[model samples]
Target: MGLADALAEWTDVDGAQYELGRATGLFADRTFLQVKWVLWSSNPLGQALYDMLHALVRAGVLEYRDEPDHQFRWRTAAPIDGLDG
Candidate 1:
């Protein structure tokens, strides 16, 4: 199988990927803690996951939102299209 297929199977077998699936469908603003929770669900000790999120914010692929509920730290952004190009 290809990389994505393999990764999907791995996450599926581990049951930790459910949170990620749920996160993708969230249309409302998401908090930092919520994003952290989703990332942590896959691997709590994965510093790379946290770093990747920070990188996205830095790249403007993800933007920080000042939701009243949050103090404005990487709170929300829809993933932009065609950044890979």
Candidate 2:
């Protein structure tokens, strides 16, 4: 599934923050991560996922934050309709 679709599944539950690496790992295989780590380029789907998330941030649909340790977190900007209540 696309990043948006996977994110929707998670956001449907709540607007809690999620780490980018952990989230990406859930959708990608270990080999993909290892190769990308060594090659310095990620898989196409990883790029697409980041692109989608950037779009969401631009649209104010999601909020992106960096923790002190440098990990990124994302959460819905507001309570999702129907799901929040």
Off by over 4 Å in 1: 1-45, 65-85
Clashing pairs in 1: none
Candidate 2, which ten residues in sequence have the lowest lDDT sum?
12-21
Clashes of each: 0, 0
Query: Candidate 1 residues 1-85, lDDT tens each?
Result: 2222323322321122222333444312654455555544655534444454446457754333334321112223335564321
Off by over 4 Å in 2: 1-41, 69-85
What digit string (tens of lDDT, one per residue) describes model 2 on residues 1-85? Answer: 3334445533421112222333556424544345443224456645655565666567556555544322222344454564321
Query: lDDT per model, in order?
Result: 0.37, 0.42
Candidate of highest lDDT: 2
Most accurate candidate by TM-score: 2
| Worst lDDT 10-window in candidate 1 | 9-18
In candidate 2, position 38 carries an lDDT of 28
